[model samples]
Target: MGEVAKIKKFLAEARYHHQEATSVDMVNVMKQYKGLVSNLEPYVFNDGTCRKLTNLSGTIPVRYKGNTYNIPVRLWLMDTHPYNSPICYVAPTADMCIKVSKFVDHNGKVYLPYLHEWDASKANLLGLVQVMITVFGEQPPVYTKSKAPYPTQQAMPTASPPYPVYPGAATPYPAMPSQAMPQPGGFPPYPSMASETPYPPAYPPASSGYPPPQQTPYPPMQPSPMASGYPPQAGVGAGGGTITEEHIRASLLSAVEDKLRRRLREQFSQGTAELETLRRTNLELVQGKSKLEGLVGRLDKDCAELDKAIATLEEKEAELEKGLGKLSSEEPIDIDEAVTTTAPLYRQLLNAFAEESAIEDVIYYLGEALRRGRIDLDAFLKQVRALSRKQFMLRALMNRCRQKAGLAG
Candidate 1:
């Protein structure tokens, strides 16, 4: 049978068993069936068939008084067997098992859990017994076919039969023509093979085919001065009808010379002004220097006069010093000695008059004798002493004679 037919048959069996089985019995049965199918070919069930079992009606699994259990439910399969399709199991509470309405994604394939709604009244008494027996029976071991089932191709009809045909026997039914197998609903259309059709040729490879148009080998161009028709040589001029190259060059030179001349004139004027200023400065310096020189000359003359005055004063001082020294060295003369040495006969006469004269006369004669230098100072002093002694003895004798003479009288 095809994969879809096999899935439909499994759903039918699950529905019949669900009506008779208790929730525990139903879970056990499902577990056994799951084990039995675990190794079956994956293509045996389509995703749509699984979804129908998950959303089955009426009987469902439920929790009563804190204990959980599965209740019998019914389902309709619309696609595989539209009429009188067997009812399948569902959970009383959608949360009891994974919702069949939800798909199971294993790798890229989708699997769905079983589901059912609950109904208390109707019972499948016989079906329940049969379901329990079926669940208890030893499960069939999982089997895998060694090779894939190949699709059979129908044989074509031949025009002639192998034996002669009876004339009136029911005409043998002509062998039916073989029809192409229907494609799987989910798979896409087959792609066309690439080898049959050719690709349009690529745009022809860029042409190097013709030798590039023969490049004319140009003659060596001669170098020309810009002054000539070509661009003016380094120091040349632009061409014009009336203006020759020489004229343009001359004009340029004249402009340059004019600029140089103006610069030179400016420099000369500056130099002249600087020179005039220096001349004035030089004149002032010369006048100042001359005045200084005259002051120096007058100072020299004053210095000379001072020197001469100092010399004359020194000469006069030296003469005065000599005279004072000579005066200090000279001795005073003795006037008496001088007179004695000069007088000759006056000495004896003065002495005789001094001895026989009266007192006044004697004083006069002594003075005369001193003036004549006749008296020796030493002899005169001795005479003066003898006279004093004589006068004293004469006084004593006169006193003695007076006493004696009176007695005698």
Candidate 2:
């Protein structure tokens, strides 16, 4: 599956509180941040409840000392996302150490003004990550142990306490103006790397692949005398029996076999992990394919139903059109003489109902005129009362006539 498809699947399985909104936000973020990978991972909240949540884990670029470094970061989206902020952490590798500062705590949890003042209308994953990159550029969250001279125990900076620092607590890693400034004897620089010169550089370049490949050293081996074009010589043993060339040959062969076995085992382990990852990817693709097929089938069924409905509507339209043509061909009849009642009593009842309906329209217009100041309040009230009394009499007459004519009232 593609990245967007994978992200949709992950969010779907996790059962987010706001699925549609969260999916849109995450899809945009994933597109902008192609390096980041989305997955469903278990997240433990402060209340100790663990839930599987969508996680975006990857590295972001931060420039320091004119060089760019890919800073690893992990974001845990809350189930009620868009409304809630994501939990962000600076994930340091084994060789890297967390540099606690105003933005990052000892536990690698990130704190930022944007996150503190999160407005769902304006704030989003893309903006949150941008703020992190900018803040980290000024004060890096993590530094490689090989590049920075970060001692196990160092004096705290005296300037001001960083976040996670209690209200009245002492500042963590406080440094004096002289120390913060890279003087002759003061700290090397604000960051203070292990090296005085930036040769190998801290972390890998931003362009390097994620989770950079490990450089495994070749197994050490002591060369055998046979390589020198000289056969092993027999030597006198401490016990009195002479050491033979065959013994030396056998020892060298055993050493070579052991090294080969270890190398093969390492390769096998790495291959197995890669195979399992491929298997998971294949399963996800299969599921996506099944879902798409089902959707297509539903769409086809709906289309067929729509076609049947259209045909029914067309038939009804044709019948109405034919009837309209017949009426057009005939002469127009006076509405009053269109139908005559069988008895005079029924005729009187119909006329009374018509007069009563006319009175209702008159009263409605009077009210509208009153509302618009077209008539005075006294006149409006007087006219409404008179019309209402006439309407009531007409209705009574209709009821009496209906009874005499044996018609339903």
Best prediction by TM-score: 2
Identify the runs in model 1 with alpha carbons over 4 angstroms from their true place: 1-242, 331-409
157-217, model 1: which lDDT tens digit per residue?
2234344433432242222222222122211132331211232111111111112221222
lDDT tens per residue, model 2, 243-333: 2344344444654564465556545544564565466558878999999999999999999999999999999999999999999999998
Cα lDDT for residue 109, model 1? 17
lDDT agreement of model 1 with the native: 0.36
Per model, state how many residue pairs clash. 23, 11
Could you tell me how far off, in angstroms, the CA of residue 129 lies in candidate 2 after the best superposition?
0.8
Model number with the top lDDT: 2
lDDT of 2: 0.68
Q: Could you tell me the C-alpha RMSD of candidate 2 in Å?
A: 21.8
Q: Which lDDT values do the candidates have, in the order given?
A: 0.36, 0.68
